[model samples]
Target: MSGGYDLNLFASPPDCNFLCSVCHGVLKRPVRLPCSHIFCKKCILRWLARQKTCPCCRKEVKRKKMVHVNKLRRTIGRLEVKCKNAEAGCSVTCPLAHRRGHQDSCPFELMACPHEGCTARVLRGALAEHRQHCPHGAQERCPLGCGATLGPVERARHNCYRELREAWSWRQERSRTLVLGLLRRMREVHRTANLVRRQLAQLGGFLEEEDAMLVGAPQGEAEATPEGSMGAEM
Candidate 1:
């Protein structure tokens, strides 16, 4: 009778699963129900909210059966340490359960634009758009004394000064060529005047020579003819 009707025969200990089905982390704040199944309180609560089932055996457990155990809370409390982002200069230390909340407001979590010359710093969510139109990003400047800042859209305008400078230099060169041509023409005129003066002097010399020759011949012929005629007439 003692072996067949023992009152303690129907009692069995609850099964404690050491692993969380979702995160695979150690079960802290273990929760248990009348079905003799155990799980972490936080993990089971989240799982129950999605579907009321035993995380270990997948047994249909009611959401009301989920209970928070103080022992597991104490265990998780001790595991809380400095945030993982502490290496990135975050000085806050919080529980793993609250780490996500702490990271949202973490000052050291700021991200700077990766684009060149962009000094803008923003949250992780806004980094994409900030990089798109980064005002301080890579830009060019006018090299031909335009003295203005330029972006990709202004590159053509920025180089306009080069063409303008070239045009001005061409005009200056044309003016210089014109002045040189006029000077060359004046030199030619001066040379022509000098040649004409020399020719005029030569012509005057020839004329004087002809006049003397004519006068001398006329005088000699007159003298010779007069003597002959006088003899013939007598």
Candidate 2:
């Protein structure tokens, strides 16, 4: 983390007391030592890591002896500061506490270019201008879903008509394959129907034979009854 706010960012010079002795910048998250000397929390902690003496008075300091000065921190927060991107054309001036918020949306902030294959870092405000002349920024893709990505150098040479023709040919081949599949399915269905018809014709012949036997059975029984009565009478 930054030890303190940049001294140059302040609208006016801060009082000497508000400066960290270790970092020589405005106190940030100020912490008072046992000797009553204050410095930025980060600066003091770092100084104590190397030597156990206060940066201001050379008094013996310990990590546990540090006391946070919330009032001083709040005071520093209220100081007016220019945007960090001021040199990049940002003119925003706000309280130290609000600097992060302003910087988040500052157009002059540096950002990596969004286009792939370009490693240039550019100010957000100048990205569009950069893209206009970037060798790899502007891109065009084949409209026929050919999966071809064209950069600025290849854009003029791109052949959309050829892509369209290839796409149409692929669709025609796919349609022919689908039609053949359907025709095969229809042939199978016709064969199944013919087999069903043949089975029904065989079943009809069996039913006709059964019906003829049923019709002749009653006449044969009647003729036997008359002969049996005449024999009984004799």
Candidate 3:
């Protein structure tokens, strides 16, 4: 039981001298067994089912011989007690008899979301339907680049810094690849320019050597022509 209600805690002692032997709490719906030992209505019924003897003195008891202790019930009803969820932060101190009822609806109770990663604390009644549309518990992937794909409930555990680091890593990798490609192209262009310069130098040297050989051949042709004309005239 939630909503600031801790049903496990023993009920406070009532004003009447009567207390249920089984639960040790103030009598609720007190009933008198045939042995004359008074017990809570639920306690006696449960005991009678297992054994037809009163728990107080082991005397024989019958299912039909039980009687209601109306006076004790009224007295217990007036007893005041702390709220069931007092340890859980509920500060209401109400009648002991009304404790169960009051705690079921107490507003100060701390109720957690059943969603896996969500730590949201809400009122008791709001828990059941709160997960139906809880954004954190929705099924989705982390867009922040952590590569986390999970349900909304588990998504609460995602780390923001890790996601940011992953984004930076991707950007760096892409930039590095682009830079390497540009450097490779530049190297290839430099190599091509060097090859072109070397070819131009080799071509210019070959043309200069051909011009020297042609100029020497033209002088030899001029001397041979003069000798042939002088011999014909003789």
Candidate 4:
């Protein structure tokens, strides 16, 4: 290969297969501990910070005697020029010494919460903690009546108030409509009574005029009229 070591250097070596268990990254600056297990110095340091054990055999390696093996560092240095996240958009090639920093801020790194209405970003190391708290992030409203924004903890309270307000508003509107309908019906009844009174007044005026005409008529002629005959019979 164009790089220093054969691309297949660690390809199932017959006697000893060498690979960094943590990243599977080519091990550079290799260090062999008293336990006869080897790991890249940087990888071992990070691994030991999290856990104190050999990556390959799970043997306990003390923090003190991790000797520097110079040959492994040179091999890893040459292999570092390949993209760590080739599937992502990272085209930069550098030594393995810089791979950790590059991967830390890789743009293609998967980070955000997958939950709806949550916008929290999670790093690979902190995904578990992020998922636990992300559900409590701000949630969107239902948008039908009173639009209220609330966090997960307060959603129940917001929904309760919203429904109550809608119910109260509906009752108030119905009451107003009922009152107005009753007033309209009452006005119609009053109008009909006024019309009946006017008609009765007209009928009374006609009766008085007839009485006056009967009194003015000749006495014998008035006595022979049907109304005067009826009055005499009564």
Candidate 5:
């Protein structure tokens, strides 16, 4: 980046009419005095505030009538300018009017250090170096959903928190497995209870039928026994 920062050499020199006589820079907000000599709007205004005379011709004027030169304003706006951070790895060039907007988007521009309590604004290309020494730069979040966060050099502190999280996770998984096993046993018990109730109902129906057959038999046949037959034979 340091090798390619000469933007002025690439751009054509601005015309004399497009330059500000006071600042010697390209015309910015040009204002045409009644004398027909043009100067930057800000330059002429600042000069008139002190004394009512044109900077170029020293012409005295009472009204100090100023008109905006739209044609020249547009011409200056089209002039090209290189990024101010061209030495910081930026190679972008845009119109002069867009310089401010382009500079904001340039990758080489400075950004505030991300570390807590640090307020250093380093260029993007140099941010790595700044972060290397920043206290909070290497911090990482706990992957096990713990609220704790720790940095690389602070590994000893993180180990205590990591072991607790792992232990809690294992206990939760074991409890879940136990609950599933209990549910399966409960389902088997419910099925066995249903089978027992059905078998009891069938046995009760068979017992009732045998009891009815004995009650409906004649009294003589029920009273006859094998003992009467054995005594008659003797």
Candidate 6:
């Protein structure tokens, strides 16, 4: 991916066979050509794309003629290597395959601040402590949830009373909204109940009229009592 692995990454000098002639670095993902010559897969691919020939022997090459050297790649993976951040005070050494993992979590590796607007690069291990003093980190909201952004100096001068008051005001407004919603839902439920009661009253009147007709009685005698029905209000 990088022409080839940097020579400085290896614990010791790599074998000449493991070196790519094009990049002059340790072979990564080694590939063999029909000319019986080996080079880094990336290096050989780029060479063939331009010249359609092997760089080492100047022999014609076809894209389909390239063969992967899995055995060599495995051997290279097993080779000892130092962390890429070794120069940044990391002293870890492991197999080449493990080098990437180690670098990923290396405490000595330089990292940009997660806080926005920060351009400083600090060691990964020191990032937490750096954030405590970083200017951009001052954007953190007030601990009381007052939504106030304050720097170190501003935080020292912040009024606890004001923060608490703001929190209280927000809670009061939220409670009012919740109460209003509940009242509206209750009113809708009451309205539905009232409509159902009115339908039952109409059905009762229809049954009374049918009963009176069957018995040959006066409609007034069989009429339903208005007081028997419930009111709309709860």
Candidate 4 backbone collisions, by pair: 29-73
List lDDT for all candidates, in order.
0.65, 0.86, 0.74, 0.66, 0.75, 0.86
Lowest lDDT 10-residue stretch of candidate 2? 137-146
Please give the lDDT score for candidate 5: 0.75
The local lDDT score (0 to 100) that residue 234 gets in candidate 6 is: 22
Best model per TM-score: 6
lDDT of 4 by residue, 1-234 (tens): 121233343223312334555555455566788887776677788788887778777888787988987776655554544444555555666665576676777655568775566777755556756755775445755444466565666654566556777999999999999999999999999999999999999999999999998878887685679887789999
Model 3 RMSD in Å is 15.3
Structural similarity to truth (TM-score) of each candidate:
0.31, 0.59, 0.42, 0.28, 0.51, 0.61
> Which candidate model has the greater lDDT, 3 or 4?
3
lDDT of 4 at 100: 68
Decoy 2 TM-score against native: 0.59
Better of 4 and 5 by TM-score: 5
TM-score of 3: 0.42
lDDT order, best first, reads 2, 6, 5, 3, 4, 1
What residue pairs clash in candidate 6, if any at all?
none
lDDT of 3 by residue, 101-155 (tens): 8867887666887655888998775675777777666765565666667775566
* Backbone clash numbers for all candidates listed: 1, 0, 4, 1, 0, 0
Which residue pairs show collisions in model 5? Answer: none
- Candidate 1, superposed: residue stretches over 4 Å from native: 1-158, 227-234
Runs in model 5 deviating more than 4 A are 1-10, 62-64, 125-133, 138-234
Candidate with more favorable, higher TM-score: 2 or 4: 2
Q: Write the per-residue lDDT of candidate 5 for residues 70-176, one digit (tens) a residue.
A: 89888777877777886776788788778889877676899998776778998877787887877666775654556567676664456765688799999999999
